[model samples]
Target: MRMIVMIIFLVLLGLLAILNRHFLTYPHTLNLGFAEYKDMPVGLMLLAASLIPMLVFYFWASVTKLRAQADTAKLLRDMESLRTSLDSQEGSRFQQLQAHLDRQFAEMQTQALPSSGSASEVASLAAKMDAMKRDLDLQLDQMDDYLKRKLG
Candidate 1:
């Protein structure tokens, strides 16, 4: 695509140069500076026209390169933000898992101990522990859903 555009631009430049030469040779009713100089050769006009377009193209090329650099910088910034968010979420998930495991271990210890009081108290504690574990699992699942949504 770039090559095709370049070819088209070169053809246009060639045409402009030809037109400049023809105009320079012809008598100018409304002569702009160089047009009044009949003694001056037609080649100079053609050269000036051709060089002007090339200079303009050079400036435009530089502008496009700078814009591309800016775009690259913005992409890098966005990537960095994503990476930071991922790292933070991972840390939070690890802490949550650790806390859940610790709570489960504590519950197991309570279950391991000998029953000293009435059966009702022990059964109540066990039931509450089970409910707490279930709630924690639900919370973890919700966290997973939130993370998936954030990533997508």
Candidate 2:
């Protein structure tokens, strides 16, 4: 839409220039040695035309730079908050893990203890194993003697 407006303005300017071509072609004769004060020179008009665009562009760039700096500062604050939160969460997790390890260590200590009268129980278990071994030896001897007699 802005391009359309600029195109229309340029077309009107061109038409006006064409219509005033005869007037622009006629040169004016000026009298010499006339004191002309407060007159604008052609160079000043050209300088104004050139410098206005540059000034506008400079102002635009500065405004955009300021906006970008503000955005960067806001993001940095957000990042700092996020970093602090993460550090706190990690610290809590480490503490939780340490507590869990301690609990597991305490549980392992409970499991390591055997029943009461452990030495007496071990002696009784050894006597039972010896009795079973003697019964197995007697059975093997009876089987050997029975087999030898049957073969004879």
Candidate 3:
């Protein structure tokens, strides 16, 4: 496809250049403060005028393309680093939460347990432990929901 377009453009350019041949031999001159060109062809003069800007634009486009690609690569690297840090932070938060839950369960056992020898006291302590276990389960479910919401 690209070659076809280029070929078509070349044919058009050949026609244009040929059509301009009558003007090509027309005498022209260009002068600078320190240098001078005399009896240059009109075609050569026209070619120079058109070519300089195209060269400039090509270089400018190439530079900008490279800069944009470099910036995109840097952005991707920064995002990957940020993602890893966030994952570590999330892991630490979960570990801390689990440790805290363990401590709470230990405290419930040590503090709510009755020293009485009565069966009633034992039963009451058992019920309290069961409730604490359910509370822990509820907290875990809430944490799972929070993570899903955050990630999704």
Candidate 4:
């Protein structure tokens, strides 16, 4: 949109200059505190003065946009690295929890087997634990998927 506006402005300026060619070319004297100029095309000088700033601003805007893009790219890369680190940490924690649960199940099986009533109770508890673990795993998977979708 800015580019289109700039183009339109340039076209209009060109048309104006073309329409007033004789006036733009007409020479006049210019005076400054320190120096004086003779036979200067003041209209053309004014036109060039206006154009120089516009050109400078356009290039400055372009450079600023490029810098912003580079910064964004760097931030994205940092985020990706952080996500990867967190995923590895989560995986290690999951493995540790599984190991702890397995050890506890083993201890429970050995101690509960000696009594018949407690054996049945242990089986029921094991079933419940398995169901809970499955639910927890499903929830974690859903959360990971949600995070991936949002970030990517």
Backbone atom clashes (below 3 Å) for every candidate? 0, 0, 0, 0
What are the Cα lDDT values of the candidates?
A: 0.70, 0.61, 0.70, 0.91
53-123: candidate 4 lDDT, tens digit per residue: 98998889889999999998898888878988998999899899999999999999999989999999999
Tell me the tens digit of each residue's lDDT in model 3 across 1-152.
44465567557766877888778767788677798888878675676576577567667877888899999879777766776687679778867976886787667656655655444565676677679767977886786677556544
What's the CA RMSD for each of the models?
7.5, 28.5, 7.8, 3.1
- Kindly list the per-residue Cα lDDT of model 2 for residues 1-152, writing each as its tens digit: 44465567557756765786655444444334685434334343443465577557667877888899999879777766775676579668856875885676556545544755654555565566558657866885686576446433
Report lDDT (Cα) of residue 121, candidate 2: 58
lDDT of 1 by residue, 25-72 (tens): 654344577655545555655566777877688779878988999998
Worst 10 residues of 3 by lDDT: 113-122
Candidate 3: C-alpha RMSD after superposition: 7.8
Candidate 3 segments exceeding 4 Å error: 1-14, 25-39, 105-152
> lDDT, candidate 2, residue 3?
44
